[model samples]
Target chain A: MPTVHVQLFKGRTADQKRAAAAAITEAVVATLGGNAATVDVIFHDIERHDWATGGKLWSDQPPAPPTPAAP
Target chain B: MPTVHVQLFKGRTADQKRAAAAAITEAVVATLGGNAATVDVIFHDIERHDWATGGKLWSDQPPAPPTPAAP
Candidate 1:
């Protein structure tokens, strides 16, 4: 049995997840030659603050503030 | 370099996650002999409703209601 774990940002709907799971299962079965029914695709939603790249958290990215009107 | 992806329920504090990451990194380095810095332990916090087992969603489990005594 192949267990596929997906790590992604939170906020996806159930339909989206279901579709993704189906696609992943199909692909794994096709590539690895196992029954699709046996494959498990689990999704893990990561909060932006908890995920970091190159020692910097995603949530720390600077936001673009609105430009001030000329006086 | 080894990347460990942990799938678990939501509600872990930052301190808990930090401890887990450190432990995991150390273990990976000891077992695989790779630089600890290169080892990544990413956490994916999942809601109970999003996770399932044996075709049943975990959130669907009936909660134990308050016990009522005979009047």
Candidate 2:
């Protein structure tokens, strides 16, 4: 069985998770040709305190400047 | 950088996690030859309801039969 685990910052709604699972499942089935039933996508909702990048915790990172929307 | 994700049943102590991270990091560094500082082993503690095998949730599986001790 092919199992995929995704760790994302928490607070996503169930709809978002369901959509992600469906899309990822389709991609896995298309690429690997496994029964769609056997493809499992497990989401780990992570708090900022639990994740770090470049030796710095996500919670402690400086605020990112806002990006302008395209006209 | 290679990122490894491990999904395990919850309730492991911090010491167990530290040991696992150390061992897995060592193996990855040995085989892949990356800086040990950059090796990340993210653990996702899965609830029985969140995991399934053979079209059934782990939470709903029948109780496992006891195995006799082997001398």
Best candidate (score: lDDT)? 2
Candidate 1 chain B lowest-lDDT run of ten: B52-61
**Candidate 1 chain A vs. true chain A: TM-score?**
0.81
Runs of candidate 2 with Cα error greater than 4 angstroms are A2-71, B63-71
lDDT of 2 by residue, B1-71 (tens): 67888878787899989988998999999999989999889997886555544334455567569767454
Docking class of 1: incorrect
Query: What tens digits encode model 1's per-residue C-alpha lDDT throughout B12-44?
Result: 799989988998899899988979988889998
Two-chain DockQ for each candidate model: 0.11, 0.12
lDDT value, residue B41 of candidate 1: 90
Recovered share of real interface contacts in candidate 2: 0.09
Clashes of 2: 0
User: For residues A1-71, what per-residue lDDT tens digits would candidate 2 score against the true structure?
Assistant: 57777778887666556666667777777898878788777777899888899989989997569767444
True contacts kept of each: 0.02, 0.09
